[model samples]
Target: MALIECKDASFAYEGVSVLEGVDFSLNAGDYLCIVGENGSGKSTLVKGLLGLKKPESGQILYGDGLKSTEIGYLPQQTMVQRDFPASVYEVVLSGCLNSLGRRLRYGPAERERAESNLERLGIEDLRDKSYQALSGGQQQRVLLARALCATKKLLLLDEPVTGLDPIATGEMYNLIKLINLCDDITVIMVSHDLHEAVRYATHILHLGRRQLFFGTSAAYRESSLARRFLGRDRI
Candidate 1:
């Protein structure tokens, strides 16, 4: 069964429809990119997928033993989050909060998960450093590790590469690819970089306050939607 399925779903905000006609299916290990301009309901759809908001029409279902609560999420950071005063280890270890359930304190298992994720991302050296003290790329890596600590099956990222340099952006993309392809984890990402989205994603779901196209990356490249949005030269 697919890990996630959006069956003719739609969403609203304050009694007004912001997005409609959403549909897609994602199996394990698939990397799907959601592409659209600002105000196209991408974030609203994400909220639905994360179980934070209910769909106004149809449903978003989870199968293959996956639940929306178990998905690792790396949301776009605000200025306040960027300067959050906490140790790197503390921040990353907090990802295991969901796994604790009724437990009041983190146990060894959660600690080990955090350590494993940090090592997986090759950031063990910065374990004791302050999270706000790191560079943008390093902070992103730390956050990725934190997200990984939360889930082994899937990741949901929103504009993860937003305020980074060219090199840092490339590094972040590579890390995401590694987590998706090598780690065999499904990835659902919302991105503005159509070029990179085409290069990395297995499937593309284009939106314009509604689903415009949903298909393989190669097929998306050939679609008129791609031509209109990315241009032939860009694709």
Candidate 2:
């Protein structure tokens, strides 16, 4: 069954269309990578999925039958985020806010869950350190641990490896693959690099101002979409 469904979705800004006639579904444990140029509405689509923006037309249906709190999101980490004063433990623990809400105290269970998530991402040692003090790779892992604390069923990561070095990007991709393979988490991500997205994603969503493409990796490889947008040499 589909976990997320969008039908005839459309969005616009200042009377200019951004997304139109977008229809797609995400099943449990599926990994979908969204690729597009800077102005192609990739970030807008993420906002739409997160309910941060209202679509001009159509609807998004979450069919996992989960509550709104169950949706987990990890947005791109910008340079400014490097200075966030929170400790790794504190940031990861914040992910439990949707579940814990305004609770006066976090009990043993919540603490355990946070620790386990950190451990799963192999960053348990950094839990007590300040988020601002960690290396780029460490910081991303910490944020990913935070997202894992939100939900195990679905993970939405937008431009996750944007500013990392090549080695860090490769490590991040390996971690993402392991998260999907071992934990069965459905991964939906937005990316600018076609090669990286194709290397890891099972499904691809290509967005243009007035056009888009959605298909499995094999199908995407077989299509001419790469030649037009990514160039033949890159493919």
Candidate 3:
């Protein structure tokens, strides 16, 4: 079964429609990339999917036993977030907050999970370092580790490589691909880089004012829609 399905989903803010007639299915282990122009409602669609905002019409179904709390999210960073005053360990462990329910403190399992994620991201040595002291790439790795503490099933990333250098961006993309391909996690990402979208994503959801295309990346490469928007750039 599909992990998530959006059936004619539409979203609006203060009754001004931003996205409409969105339909798609994300199967388990699919690396789905959402691509569009700046004002094409990509972020708004993500909010609707994450239940941070409700759709104005239609349905978003979570199948394959998926739940909102079980999905990991790495949001776009702001200047304030970049300078957040906290230890790496503290920031990573906070990903467990949603799953803590009424608990006042983290249990052993949560700590273990946090540590494991740190190791997985090759940042275990930096666990005690101050978050604000790290470089942009290091900060993103810490955040990814934090998100991993939330779930192993699915990950949602919004422009994860936005401000990094090319080397850092490539490293981040490889790490995300490892999570999707090796760790067996499903991925849904919102990205503006069409080149990276074509190179890394298995499925593409190209959103215009509406959903212009939704299909496998291979299909998108052959479609006229891709031609018009992306030109004839080879993946």
Candidate 4:
């Protein structure tokens, strides 16, 4: 079964429609990239999928043992968030808070998971480091570890490489690709980098002002939408 399905989904803010009649499905181990122009409701669609916003019409279905709260999320960072006062371990361990319910302390299992994620990201050495003292790339890796502590089934990333230099951006993409392919985690990403999207994603969902395109990456490369917006350039 599909991990997540959107049937005729639509969203609005203050009654002004931002997305309408959107339909899609995400399967296990699929890397789905959502791309669009500004104001095309890419972020809104993600909010709807995450259940942070109620769709104006239609339904979002979750199957294959997936729950709304079990999905890991890596949001776009702000300057203030980049300078947050905390240790890397502290931030990552907090991701288990959702599973703790009313508990005040983390269990041994949660701690193990956090440490395992840190090691998986090859940032075990930075566990005790101050979050603000790390480079931009390291900071993003820490955040990814935090998100992994939340779930192993699925990850939602929004503009994860927004502020990094090209080298950092490439590293981040490689990390995410490894997580998706090796860890077998389904990835749903909101990205503006069309070139990288085509390179990394297995499937593409392109949202225009009033149009939608969904298909395999190879097929998307041949669509008029890709030709018009992305052009023939591979970069």
Candidate 5:
């Protein structure tokens, strides 16, 4: 069964349609990369999926089983996060806050999950380190570990590799690929790196000014529009 299903979804701001007639389905283990220009409504679509914004028309369904918070999200790190004075362990443990049962303390399961996520991401040694003291790649991994502490079912990433160096970018993509491909988790990510997306993603969701294209990576490579925008050899 599909994990997420969208039917004829459209989102508007002040009656100005940003996304129109969008439809897509995501299954477990599917990795879909979202591609578009600056004003192509990629974030808006993400917001809609996150339930932060309601679509003006149509429906969005999450398999009638997953909780809203179960959709793990790794947003682009901003300047605010870079300067935050929290330990990496503290930040990761925060992912367990929402799942707590009105308690004022961390349960054994929550702590174990956080620790496991950090260990899985190879940041167990940095658990006591300050968040701001880590390098850009380490910071990204910490945030991902935090997200993974919540759930491994559905993952959403928004421009997660923006300012990182090439090696960091490659490593981050490889981690995400492992989560989606090896762990059987579903991924819906917004990416500016067409080359990485083409190499890793099984499906591509392209958003234009007022249109959307949903297809497999090979199908996107065959389209003239995708070829023009994403480049011929790039895909």
Candidate 6:
């Protein structure tokens, strides 16, 4: 079954329609990259998928027993978020907050899950370190591990490598791919790098305030849509 589907969905930004006619379905283990220009509503669509906003028209459906709260989301970081004063372990352990629902304390399972994800991301050694003291790449790794603690089924990342150096960017992409390929978690990412998006994603969803293309990466590369974007692409 589809993990999530959007049927002629339309979304608004502060009550003005910004994206419309979106239609696609992501199945289990699918890696979808949402690509668009700056004002094309990519972030708005992510919010809608996360249930942060309701669609202005049409539907956003979730299947396979997936709930919005069950999605592990790693949003674009702001300066304040980057400067957050917290220990790495404390930050990651908070990803289990959604699963805790009426609970007041972290159970053994939650702590174990946090520890496992830290090890999974190869950041166990940073457990007791201060979050703000880490490098940009290391902080992102910590955040990625935190997101993993939220769900085993889906991961939603928005421009995950925004400020990383070339090496760190490559490592981040490799880690995300490993999560999808090995852990079998479904991934939906909003990205500006069309080249990288097509290279790593199994599928692509191109938006320009409206649905432009939806298909496999190979098909997208062959389509005129890819040519148009690549022509203007700096890469």
Q: Pick the candidate with the highest lDDT.
A: 6
Which tens-of-lDDT digit does each residue in 48-104 have in candidate 4?
A: 888899999899999998988888999889788777899999999988877898888
Q: How good is model 1 by TM-score?
A: 0.98
Residue 214, candidate 6: Cα error in Å is: 0.6
Q: For residue 114, what is the lDDT in candidate 3?
A: 93
RMSD (Cα, Å) of model 4: 1.1
Candidate 1: minimum summed lDDT over ten consecutive residues — where?
Answer: 226-235
Residue 151 lDDT, candidate 1, scale 0-100:
83
Q: Write the per-residue lDDT of candidate 2 for residues 54-142, one digit (tens) a residue.
A: 88989877886754457688988876888989889999998877778778877788899999999998898898899999988888899
Off by over 4 Å in 2: none
Using TM-score as the measure, name the better of candidate 1 and candidate 5. Answer: 1
TM-score of each: 0.98, 0.94, 0.97, 0.97, 0.96, 0.97
Misplaced by over 4 Å in model 5 are none
Q: How far is 66's C-alpha from truth in model 6 (Å)? A: 0.4
**Across residues 1-235, which tens digit of lDDT does each residue of candidate 3 receive?**
7899999999888989999999999888999999999999899998988888888999998998888878899998888987788999999999988779899999999999999999999999999999999999999999999989998788999999999999999999999999999898999999999888988999999998789999999999999988877777554
Which one is best on TM-score? 1
Q: Model 2 TM-score?
A: 0.94
**Models ranked on TM-score:** 1, 3, 4, 6, 5, 2
Higher-lDDT candidate among 3 and 5? 3
lDDT of 6: 0.94
Please report, in order, the local distance difference test score of every candidate based on alpha carbons: 0.92, 0.85, 0.92, 0.91, 0.87, 0.94
213: Cα error in model 2, Å: 0.4
Model 3 ranges off by over 4 Å: none
Residue pairs with backbone overlap in model 6: none
Number of clashes recorded per candidate = 0, 0, 0, 0, 0, 0
What's the CA error at residue 93 for candidate 5, in Å?
0.8
Residue 123 of model 5, lDDT score: 92
**Superior candidate under lDDT, 3 versus 4:** 3
